[model samples]
Target: MKLCVIPARGGSKRIPRKNIKEFCGQPIIAYSIQAARKTGLFDHIVVSTDDDEIAEIARSYGAETPFRRPAEISDDHTGTNAVVKHAILWFQENGTPVDLVCCIYATAPFVQEDYLQLGHDKLIQSDKSFAFSVTSFPFPIQRALKITQNGGLSAFYPEFRSTRSQDLEDAYHDAGQFYWGSAKAFLQEHELFSNQSLPILLPRHLVQDIDTPEDWIRAEYMYKAIHSSI
Candidate 1:
């Protein structure tokens, strides 16, 4: 069986109530739930959260809140792997045997259903433990800069300073949207960014990280630009 697990903790420090905060028109998490529902991929779409309001909102958007996440795993220090492992264990104990699972982020407003389907297709066909969203860096990461403690700038790789941008190897990063993996992979806490993971590349414009108010504004504009036609 395929399971969709969305991890939403209530202790966001940078942006308060970020998980359910409105973006564009509705709660940001609503988009994720809607995308999962639209794909018709998962046997059970569930949201694992610590807050009552989050659970209620998730259910309203057609996701199952089978259990409240434990406080130990709901803190800011908690990691995605721990939250996902908890959900997988819950299913195993409840007699629901899930073969494949996807951990969709609660704040991913730009998530696409087609990519989710694509990731699932890749995961099933390959021996990799994961197939998740990833996107190329707008500029090569090889020539990244850093600010020195002396208030001056320094190149992370000074050797690449004279190299042309096009000559630099292309780089990519986790879009922080969704992660699809086998139930065993989640339970075993396998790393998600290794050779064992398949990359489901997404257009960079569709990827946004909404951590602060400025990020929220940029995301709103980007969302309008792409979704205006729809």
Candidate 2:
């Protein structure tokens, strides 16, 4: 069986109730649940959360809340792999073992069924242990600058200062959307960013980090631009 696990903790310091906070017209978490369902990929769609409200919201949107995440793994310091491991163990304990698991982020408003399908297909077809979302950086990272303690700017790579932007190698970063992995890789807690993984590149316009309030506003604009009706 294939499983889709969404890790949504309640203690969001930046935006309280962020998992269930309305994005566009529905709760942010709804998008994730809907996307997982739309793909017809997984046998189960589970939401790992500590808050009762979050659990209820997830179930309302057609995701299973088989277990409330323990405080130890629900805290701010808990990494996503740990939560995913816990969910896998839960099913294993019930004699319903899964072969592949997909970790979908609750804050990913731009996630689509086709992208999830691509990640899963890539993971199954490739030798890599995992496949996840990524997008090219809007600007070249080689030209990055840093501010000194005294407020003076310095090039992180002085050699690149003289190079034209077009000459620099293309850079990409994790889209922070979803990850599809074999049960073995996730159970072993292997690194996801290494060469052992493949990336399902997304369009830059579909990628947005909704962390701070400013990011939230920027995401709203981006979302509208991506989906004309929204």
User: Which candidate comes out best when scored by lDDT?
Assistant: 2
List where candidate 2 sits over 4 angstroms from the true fold: none
Q: After superposition, how far is residue 9 of candidate 1 from its true place, in Å?
A: 1.3
Candidate 1 lDDT at 195 equals 91
lDDT on C-alpha atoms for all candidate structures: 0.92, 0.93
Error of 1 at 122 (Å): 0.8
Model 1 stretches with alpha carbons more than 4 Å out: none
The CA lDDT at 142 in model 2 is 95
Q: Taking the tens digit of each residue's C-alpha lDDT, what string does model 2 give over 46-163?
A: 9999999999999999999999999999888899999999999999999998899999999999999999999998889888899999999999999999999999999999999989
Cand. 2 Cα-lDDT: 0.93
Model 2 lDDT at residue 207: 93
Residue 202 lDDT in candidate 2:
97
lDDT of 1 by residue, 1-230 (tens): 88999998888888899999998899999999999999999889999999999999999999999999999999878999899889988988999888999999998999999999999999899999999999999988988899999999999999999999988999999999999999898888888779999999999999998889899999999999998977
After aligning candidate 1 to the native by TM-score, how far in Å is the CA of 39 from where it should be? 0.7
Error of 2 at 39 (Å): 0.2
